[model samples]
Target: MEPGTARIAVDLLGGDDAPAVVVDGALRAMRADPDLHLLLVGPTEVADALIAALDPAERARITVRPVRSAVGMADHPSAARSESTVRAAVTAVRDGTADALVSAGATGATVTAAVLGLGRWPEIRQPALVATLPAVAGPVVLLDVGGSLEPRPATLARHAVLGAAYAAVAHSVVAPRVGLLSVGTEAGKGDRVRRATDPLLAVEPLPCGARYVGLVEGYDVALGARADVVVTDGFTGNVLLKAIEGAYAMAGGPPVGGGAPRAAALLGVAGTVVVCHGSARADDVASGIALAAHLWRRRATELVSALLDGDAATDRTDRSTDTEVRTS
Candidate 1:
């Protein structure tokens, strides 16, 4: 829609419904994005079915990668499967055949494949999965949805930086307000990790003119009344995200703004990747593919990496100055 070519690799066998929903989603994405080219990664037959349904004009934008193997949601993520479709999708991004990849597979498998295939950004130990939720004020960026289940204090601080940069670049959030997700807005609330990370985030110089807003409650994530980016451990963040989605469903659809996204963008990886919920519907899969395209087009991944490098350099200079003064 933004008028650029975005070639995305889609895993045809990654979701609960396998090739059916994946194929349907691919069709929707292709139709919605005239400039989008998709490398359908799955069995030849499934890709053929999708090709048959597309018009000649749409068909010209498609290419099939023909992967026959996949590890289901129930399968072990660390299992020695050499030819999983998710892995092949990553390969496409790494090889420049695709600008990005979208998969509704096991989060663990997707994260592992991306890290192993594309590598991680420097100083990023535990890459995060970030989800953007529509809030009353604007879109709120929440991170560590499932990437690192139990990240350390430093990891949480790093995610704050990533989320701030992402919100500014991808969502146009200016002077983004960052907060640590906790039980209360108080300083010493929440678990040990949140407590430890609060001070670190307060001192960490965020890019894009962002500043820390201290600890914020779960309501802040939905209302956007306090922070634009909320950072937390993946275990807590994942649980909270699902709970919010369930609440939205029970209310008989989402609010006027928008609903919780069924997909998350993986940060700290060198390439653009999106992971949908494993039980994603066709629409969900389509949304994931679209998100991946948007990120690739915006060059969000590369821009965020550059910001982090600049921040790191500043820290080193400040530390060097302090050391010189202490010795003087």
Candidate 2:
């Protein structure tokens, strides 16, 4: 762990098993990193239970944000109840009481909470959920895992930029090769959206010395011989991620190098946020927490945001010149 203290706000009521599983994950994380601090946002009793289990010294590193019933009520709805806890967690980050956030709740709810609390980056209409898969070559960055299920071609192109910058900034990959996820490696091989996005990505300026490699097939994602970053719409990306995870499990275990990861980094937001699979186990949660700490220490979010701004500026200039020439 880095020397700087990283305070993470965890949503105690966000998961299916919640509170219990979250408590276990939090305790594990606290024990793993000495400099880690957790702000548990949920019902007071649940937070207290976790604190009581920890040693006095360890307990001191934990804080609690009590959440009760919200104003709206229909004999106590499930959505409203969970929203209260997630909102409180978001509030902690917004108030600077926490450096980052980790949650295993519904993807849509988490995205909504983060957007409302931290605010989205300028010109990032649809925030992307980026997942890193440990490939034979190295880690492969895949984006739009669950954020913008049916994004436009422009959004797919934007995500390519985001994924490339993230891979370079967060993972320190040099000259990342970006690839559009399609049915085949051919130029015009996928659905209508992929076919349209291919040309756009080919022309889009990527940050961190990144370059577009046209189109890549699903096999290229795990093999990682073709591209370092894979971009696709959320619907396809989500399904593909799960299928890969399932394949790893069926093969007895993930490859020695690494398999598909359960946690993802939320890009296009102002803060470092990680969202784990809703069915995440204790180990998954612990990993998610660690990822957030790493990102916060590296200042990944701010650096990636700067990269996107630079790319956007370049795109604007290129478009303006093209329009001028066509008219003149």
Question: Candidate 1 clashing pairs?
Answer: none
True-structure RMSD, every candidate:
4.4, 4.4
Total clashes for model 2: 0
How many clashing pairs per prediction, in order? 0, 0
Query: How does candidate 2 fare on TM-score?
Result: 0.92
Tens-digit lDDT string for candidate 1 (1-328): 4779999999887866766888999999889889999999877877899999998999999999976454243353422232388899999999999999998877888899999999999989999999999998999999989999889999899999899899998998998999999999988998888888999997887888888999999999789999999999898889999999999999999999778899999999999999999888899999999999999889999988888777765644485543333222
Per-residue lDDT of model 2, residues 117-147, tens digit only: 8999987999999999988888999998999
Candidate 2 residue pairs in backbone clash: none
Model 1, which residues run further than 4 Å from truth? Answer: 68-83, 316-328
